[model samples]
Target: MLHRHPLRHAALLIPIAILAAVSSAQKADSIHYDEHTRIFRMDAADVTYAFGVNNVEELEPVYWGRAVAANDPLPAPHTMPEASSNDSAPTVTPKEYAGWGGGLYPEPALKVTFPDGNRDLVLHYVSHKINGDELIITVKDIERAVFVDLHYSIDPATGIIGRWAVIENKTSTPIMIEAAAAATWNLPRDTDYSLRYLTGRWAGEWQLQKQAILPGETVLQSKRGSTSHQNNPWFAIERGEHPDEESGDVWFGALAWSGSWRISVEQDQLQQIRVTGGFNPFDFGYKLAPGKQLETPKFFGGYSHEGIGEASRILHRFELTKVLPQGPMPKPRPVIYNSWEATEFHVDEPGQSALAEKAASIGVERFIMDDGWFGQRKDDHAGLGDWYVNKEKFPNGLKPLIDKVHSLNMDFGLWVEPEMVNPDSDLYRKHPDWVLNFPGRPRTEGRNQLVLNLARKDVRDYVYNFLDDLLSHNQIAFLKWDYNRNWSEPGWPAVAPDDQKEVYVEYTRNLYGILAELRAKHPGVEIESCASGGGRVDLGILRYTDEVWPSDNTDAFDRLRIQDGFTYAYTPEVMMAWVTDSPGWTNNRTTSVAYRFLSSMQGSLGVGANLNKWGPEDFATAKQLIEAYKGIRETVQHGSLYRLVSPRDGSETSVTESVSSDKKQAALFTFLHSSTMNYPYPRVFLRGLDPKTTYAVTSIYGRLSKDTPTSASGSYWMSHGVDVELKGDFQTAAFRFDAK
Candidate 1:
C-alpha cells in the first residue's frame, strides 16, 4: 500500500549521421556477405557476428566474438553429424531460427496448430536481402502458407544488434499460434560459461544475481501483465569463471517488450548455449485469421572482450546516442524535487508553494507535486480513475500552483496513474465493464485498484482523451506517469474468446500509442515511467519515457548496491536517485546529509527530503553539493563509466569513475562502509583518460592524502593513483578532474 515514494526500441537503426564520428576505415566495410560460402558477417566497434545457411537449408551460427578481419577463415556451412540414434541432426545442429516440428525440440522459435488438427510445421529459407545496414531473411513452412520474416540491424558505435520478427498467416483458415520468438542467439560450446541477471522484489529490485549455465533450461519471465520487478529482461554470459569488472569476455542482451515476456537460456545435448526470448507462452493463443499479421518487439545483443564494465559502457553509449529522445545528443537531466515524502497525500497549494520556494533555493529545476493533487485522492484506496482537481484541496485548480512554481524559476510537474481505477470512484461506478475481468470470476485487487483494459478500443481512447485534455488545459512541463500494481483477471470480454489472450500484446501496444500521440502533441512536456518502483521498465517503454525510478528503497547505503546493479543493464543518464530523510523509511538508519547527497549525485540528481524539517546547516550543505554536481553533470550523465570497485560480497569499500566523451573531464566517487582493523581505503586508479594530457584535481569532500598531487599528467594519475582518507562508518568522498 503506500509503503514509500508512491508515485513513485523500436528497431532503432544507427543513424547515418553517427557514422561521421567513426573512422572512415572502419565504416567502409561494416557488413558483408559471401555468396560462395552462403555466409554473412558484420562488424561494429570491437566485435563481430557471422552466420550462414547450411546444406540442410537451416541458418546456422558460424562465429560470434571479438572483431576479425574480413578475410579471416571460417567454417563452411554444413549439417552437423549426429552422434547417436537419440541425437538427430535437427537436435545436434544449432539453427539460428527453428520451428516446432521435425523431431526438433529445444524451445522452438515458432509453434502453431492448424484448424485441420495438423500441428507439424517446418521452415526453410526462401530468400534474403540486405539494404545498407539492415538484413531481412524470409522463411516459410515446408507445406503450409505460414511465413516468417526475420529482421536484423547493428549499431556501429556499440556493436549491439537489434532483432525482431514478423509472422504472416497467408492461408485461408484461422491458425492458432501457440508460441513465437523474436530471435535465437547462439554461443560457442563452452563448459565454464556463467549467466548473470538482475532479480529482486518490491523494495529490493535490481539485485545482481549469477549462476552456472548448466545442462537444462533457466527460464526468466514475467507473467504479471507488466514487466514485473521479479526479473528484468536482461542477461550477461561470462566465458570464464574468473571474469572480473574490467578484464574478460562478456556477451549481453536485453528484451525490448514491456508486457508478459520470457527469455529461455538452454544448453542442449551438444553443449551449445541458446537464448530464445519474446512473448511468454503461458495461457497464450493468438488466432490468425486469413491474412492478419503480428510483429514482435525488438531484441538487442552485444559483446565486450574487455569485460563486464566495458559491456555496460557500450550499452550506455548506445542508449544516449541512439535510443534516447533528441538523440545523437540529448539534453542533460534537470535536477528535480519531488514532494511525495514531503507532503504525501495531504498536498495543498500553499504547502506545495512553500516547498517549491525551498527547492528553488537549492537549484532544483523541476518541481513535482506527487499524489493527492486530484480526484478526491486523500489516500490510496479511492478516486484513482476520476482525474479532476479536488475542490477542497485546490479551489483555483493546478494553474495557481503551476504559476507559483514558474515564478520561483522552476517548472511544474504532476503525478497521474492513468491505467488504474478504484472501485469507489465515479468512473468505476459508471463503467463497471471498463476494467479487465471475467464474466463470472472474482476480480483480484492490488493496492486497492483494478487495471484498466486498454486492449479495448473504447477504453484506450478514453485514457488518451483525458490525458490529452489535461496537458492541453494546463501549463505542465512534465508528467510522472506511474503504474502502481500488476494485472489480475486479465480478460477482455469485448473480443471473442479465441482472441482474449491477445490482451497481453494489445494492451502494451495501445499504451505505447498513447505516449507517442501525447509526445507529438506536446513537444515541450517530458514524462517519467514509474511502476511501484521499476516494475514496467524495458527498452520498449524507454523509447517513449524520459527517466525511471529504480526502487522505492531510498536508503543511501542500500542504494550503493542497488544502483550498481542497475547500471549493468541500463545507463545512469535516466536513473533518478533521490535523497530522503536521515532515519530512512526502509531501514531506519541515520546517515549524514553529506553522505546522502553524494550517493544521489552519482545519477540524475534529485532531492525528495522534507525541506520543512531541514535546518540552516542542512540547506547550506545541499546548495553547495548541488552546485558541485552541476559542474560534473556532463561527465556523469554522458561519459564512460568505470566501475573500479564493486559493492558486492561484503566489501568494505566501493568506487566508481566517469570520464567525459572528449576525455577532458572526469568524476570519481568513493564510498566506505567502515574502517575495519585500522585499514585505510584503497588507492583509486582512474581509467578512460588521455595519457598525454595534464589534469588538475579538486576535491568536493574529504581530505586528500599527503602524497596526492594537485596537478599531474593523465598517465601519472592512471599509474600512480591518488589517495583520500575516509574513516568511520558510512563515509563518502568525491573528486573532479579537469583537463589542463
Candidate 2:
C-alpha cells in the first residue's frame, strides 16, 4: 500500500521516468546469445559485459570490458590450493554471483538462512527474458521453490550497467534472509589490483584511500544505518600501480542505497576476483513470508579504459542525464548566502532581514535561514519535531523574512531536520512512542536528539504533514534537509518481534517516499542533503536532492582534499561548497576573502561567512567575486573537470580546469598553499582542450598575484603549459579562457 495523504495543493505528478529499452535485444547494443555454446553476450558502448552458465548450472563471467572477439572463454584446468585433494577438482570452482553450497571461502554473494535450518542453496538456471532495455535472468534453488531474478540494464550512452536482484520465496514457508546482495561483478584475474575507496570522520568526510587489493576480502561499508561518513559505499579497482587522476584502466561500482550498505572486494587464492554489494547485515535481517519477495538496491558499475578521469566523466554524464532531479539537464545552482555562521540559533526576524538586505547588495541569489526558526529551538537540545515558527523569533511567522528576501530579488530557503526530535519538544512529549525504541530499554541519544521512527506509519505521516504544510504556508524555494545523528539502538517496538530489523531499510524507503510526495506537492522547491555534515551524501540521497553539503569544515585549505575525495565519486555539480569566515572556526586557518571565493567557486558556491562583521572593502570584494563567478557559473557547473595538479601530492599548488559542454569556454582555478624562498612554480599542462584552437585567457576580478598571457594557442597551452606564481600562504588565482 502506498503511504500517501491527499496533498492540499498537489500538482500533476510528473512521473520519474526510467530509461526506455533498446529497440531490439538482438541489436548491437544488447544481449546476444550463442546457440551452440549457450553463452550470453551483453554489449555496452565500448565494453562487453558477458556471463554464461557453466556445466554445473552456476553463472560464470566471460568478459567485462573492451569488447573482444573470443567466444565462451572458459577457465583452464586448475587445482585449488585452499582445498584438499578430494575437494580440489576444478569442477567445484566458485562461480560468479556465487551462492552458498559451493566450496567458497570468500563471502558468498547471496546467503539466505531458511526456516528449515538448511543454509545451503545451489542455484540452477530457470529462464531468461529481455523486456525493453533490461535483461532479466531467473535462477531457482535446486531443492526449493525459491526464485532469484537478476536484472541487468545499461544506458547505451555511458555504458553504465545497473544490476540488482529480487529473491522471492515461492514456497509456503517463511525464509530468513540474513545476507542478500544485489549482484557480484567479476573482473579479470591476470593483473595486480589496487583498490580505492573513500573514508573520513565527522567534519572531515570523503578522504580517498587507495591500497593494493591483496588476496583477501576487503570491505568498504557503512553500518551507521545511513550512508556513514566513516566509509562510503563505493569502490574502484585499478591494475598494478596507483593510477593518477587522468590515466588507468579503472572498474568502479557504487550502491544506490541510503541506509546501511556494504561492498566487498575479494581476490581468491587462485587470483579470481569479484565485488559484491548490498545491505549491511549489522543489526539487519528480513523475514520474507510465503509468496513475498525481497528486492535489493541497484549496484551500478562502469568501465573506463582511459583511466579514473574517464570514469568520473562517465559517472557524471550518467548522473546528469538520468539519475538527478530535473532530469537530463540540471537546473543551475544559485549563489547562496546561509545564515548559520552569522547567527547560529540566535535567529530573529529583524536580524535576518538586515542580512537579507546585505545579501542582496552583494550578489547572493538565494538567502537561507538556517536552524533556530522553528519552535523553541534556541539550541540543539530542544524544540526539534515542532514545525511551527517560533513566535518569539519571528513574531508574525516567516512571511516577514520571506517577503523581505523575495523583494530583494533572492529566493528564500530554510533548514529542517524533520526526522529528529528533542525530548523537550511538544511533538515528542505528545508522542514519545513515535520514536525508535525497544520496550524498557534505554534510548541512546546523539546530539541530545532521538531518531524518529519513520518506519512507523504515524511518524511518517506527521513528518510528511509538517513538511507539506511548511511549504504550503511559506514561499520557501529550497530546504536544507539535515540528518544530525546516526542510528544507535535502532528498534521499532510497534513492529512484530521478529520484524524489527526491517527498520534499518524501511526508514530510508519511507524517507524517500516522503521526499517524493513532498516534491509532488511542491514542484518548485529544491533540497540539499546534509548530515552531521556529509554523512548521508551518496548516489542514493543525490537522487532526491538538488545539492549536498560536502562537509562542515569549510576552511578552504582542508576543503581542497575533502572536495577532491567527494568529486572522485560524485560530480561537482551537486557539491555545495561554501566560502566561510577564516581562521575558520572549523580549522583555525586564516586566508584572504579572494582565496576563499576562488576555492568555493570550483563547484556549486555558497557563502557562510558573517557578512555583518565585514567592512566596506570585504563587501566590495565579495560583490566583485560573486559577479565574476556568475559569469562562468554554467561552464564550471556543467563543464568537464580536469584535476591538473592534486593537493594530495604534497604540492604547494593545486590547479583544476573545467571546459564547458560546448567547448567554447573554460574556467581554471589555482591555489598556492604556501611559497618557498623564491622558487619558481611548475608549469601546469592543461587537458581536455582542442590542439588546433586558439584561446583568449583572462583573470577574473584581477585579484591574483601575476598576469597570464591574453591569448595562446591550445597547442601551446597543452604542450608548454602555463606557469602560475604566487608569494604568500593561502593565496589563490582564477582564470577564464574563451575559445577563439
Candidate 3:
C-alpha cells in the first residue's frame, strides 16, 4: 500500500550515519592464529575463514563460512593407520602451500628450478612474527638455502586478508624460479565445486564463465605479456550447496598484478580444490641472485556467507578504502565524453572543439580527445611513440582544443600510448633499440605497434619526459594512458643477461612509477588505465588510474553482462561505461538510446556516440538522460549495490539497485531484453533499503501505470515487488527512490 505523507519527501530523508559508520569503522584479531594450536581464523563482517596446521607441519584449511570453530582439523597422512602406504590412504594433496613432496600434490604453490634442473621444494615452518595488524609466517626449504615468508595483513574492520609470499635467495648461486605463486587458498570440500571467472578476447571482454571445477587443473592466465583480454585475474568460488548469488558461501580472490598473471584451480581426485595465483610462470622465470628477494603481488581473498552480492560489497568496500590511491571515501565519478567514437582518428582542433561543445550541451563534465592529435597518427599504424602534437592536425598544438574544452566548463583529457612505438615512426627510427626485443629475434607487432622497453632506464626517462612535458605544456586535467600491445621477444639487451628477465616485472613497476610521478607533479590531474580495453585493469593499475575502460564493445546489450562480470571483483566506480551508436562496432547490435543510457549509467557513464550523426530526438533524449543521471550519480558510485537479477541466467529481465551510504536515496535500474507473448515483466523486488522506512518513487525512464503506488514502505516494496507489463525488445527503466 502507498504511504500518503503530507510532508515533503525531503523531510523523511535522514543521513544514514549508523550504516556509514559500520561500513567505514568495521575492526581488525577478528583474524587470529594461535601459535600453540596452529589454527588461523579470519572474520569479516558476518563470515569467518578458518584454517589450521596439522602435526606434519602442513597447513590445511579448516572451514570457511558463518562463525564457528573448525571441527577436528584433518589428521596427518603419515599418522593415519589404514595400512599407511605411498598411496591408498585419504591423502590431502592440496596443501596451504603445495610443493614437490610426498603424496602427489597436483598444483605446487612454490617451485624453484635450480641450475641442475632440480625442482624440489620442501618448505617447513621455521618461525612466526606478529607485527601489530599483520602476521608473518616464515618457512625454509629443508635441503636448499631458500626461505619463503608468507605475509597476511588483516583489516579487522573489513576482514580483508592481503596475502603475499616472499621468496628469499639465501644461496650463493642465483636461483631460477620456475613457478612461485603469490598465495594458495584452500576452500572447504563439503560443497560441490563451482568456479566463476571472466574470459574473453579483444572486443569481447569480461564474459563471465562458470563451471564445475573439473578434474586435473583449469588454468586461467594471460601469457600475452600484458594482462591480456583473454583472462582476468579474479575468481569467485561458489559451492553447489549454495549456488545462487544471494545465497551462498562465495569465496573470492584477485591477484593485484597488471602484468602477465595466472590462476590455477586444481581439483584432485578427491574433489578438493586448491587455487593458486601469481605471475604467469609460462616462458617466465625470475632469477634471484644471492641475498636477493622476490616478493609476489598481493593476492587477497574473503569469504561471504550471505551471497555473491555481499561478497562484491565487501570487495568494493575494501577497494575503496584500501586499494585505490584516493583513500576511504571517494568522490563521485563525473560524466565523461570520449572523442574516439565520434571523431575516430580524424581529430583536429576545430573538430574536437565542436564535439566538446556538443558534449557540454549534454552535461558531459570531462572532454577526452582520444588519439590522432599527435604526430603522424592519422591511423593506428604510425606516430605512436611520438608524444608531440601533430602540427598538421593541431596547427597551434593541443592548447587550442584544450582551451576550448575548458571554456565549455569541461575538464580536458588527452590519449597517449606511452608504452608503444610505431615501427615506421620518427621516434622508432631515432631509438630502434628502445623497443622490447631480443637481439637477432623477430619482434612481433600488435596493432601495428611495438612495446617499448620501459624496463630500461633510458627508455623510461625518454617516455616520462615527453609525457611530463606534454602535461606541463598543456592544460590537461586527465590522461587516457593506453598500452595497446604486449611483449613479444621479451628481452632487454641493454641490461645483463640475468637482468633481462627482470623486464617483465620492472616494466609494470616503472609504468606505475611514471604514473605516480605524473600525478605527484600534477596533483589535480587524473589518469585512466586503458590497455586495448581492460587488458591492464587490476588493483596494481587502479592504484594509479582513476578509471578503466572495460572493453571496446559498447553495445548496450553486451555491456550488461560485461559490467556484471567486472563488478564481481571490481567496483563500478572504476568501470568506465560508454554509450555509443545504436549499431556498435563490436557486436553490431542496435539498441534504443534509453536502453543504452540506462545500461551505461550502471557505472561511470560516458557518451562515445557521434554527436554529428545523432538526430534531434536522439540529442534531446540524451540531454534528458544525462540530466537524470546526475541526480543519482553519487548514490550509484559510492553506495551498497544489489544485484537483484542476472542477465546471465538467460532470463528476459535484469535488475540492480544502489542505496546511498546514508540509506536516504536509492536508484534502481531494470532492463527487459525482449518481452514474450503473454509473459509480463515480473514483479521487481527492491533491495539495499531500510525495510522500516517509507520511500517516494519517481520514474526516471518509463511510465508507471495508474493504480501503481507512488510511495510505499521499503518492506512493502521489497516483499511485494512492483510488476510491469511492458512488452518490447530492449526495454529499460530506472527509478529514483527517496526515503520519506
C-alpha lDDT of all candidate models, in order = 0.88, 0.82, 0.80
Q: Which stretches of candidate 3 lie over 4 Å from their true place?
A: 1-28, 31-33, 69-94, 101-104, 496-498
Against the correct fold, how does model 2 do in TM-score?
A: 0.93
lDDT of 1 by residue, 346-403 (tens): 9998999999999999999999999988887889999999999998999999999999
Candidate 1 segments whose C-alpha is farther than 4 A from its true place: 1-29
Candidate 3 C-alpha lDDT tens digits along 1-740: 42211222231143111111112222344545543455566665566665554444555565655654333242221212223354432245446665664444567777777887777676666677767667788887767789999888876656777889989999889888878788888776643778888998777788889887777788999887778788999898887655676777788898888888889988765667888998888877788989999988889888887778888998898888888777587777889999998888999888899999999998899999998888888898888887777899888887778778888999998888888899989999999999888899898898999988888898889988998898788888888888887778888898788668777788888888898898899888888888888788888888888888898878898889888888988988889999898787776778899999999999999999999898889889999999999999988887889988888868788888989888889999999988777687888888878899989999989865566799998888889888764678988989999998
Ranking by lDDT: 1, 2, 3
What lDDT tens digits, residue by residue, belong to model 2 across residues 1-740?
Answer: 42111221111132211212223535554666554344566777787777665554566676788755443243321123445655442323545565675445667667778886988776767778877678888988878888999899888888898999999999888888888788888888755789889999988898888888777788888888899889988888887575767777889988999999999888866677788899887777898899998888889999988888778878888887778987789987999999999999999999999999998998999999999998889999899999999898988999988999999999999999999999989988999998888779998999999999999988899999999999999999999999999988788888787899988878999999999899888999999999978988777877888999889989899889888888878888999989999788886889989988988999999999998899999999999999999989988887888888888868788888988887778888988887789776667788888878899888883333245567888887789777776667788778888899
Task: Compare candidates 1 and 2 on TM-score and give the better one.
Answer: 1
Clashes of each: 0, 3, 6
What's the lDDT for candidate 3? 0.80
| Model 1: per-residue Cα lDDT at residue 141 | 86
**Model 2, residue 124: what's the lDDT?**
69
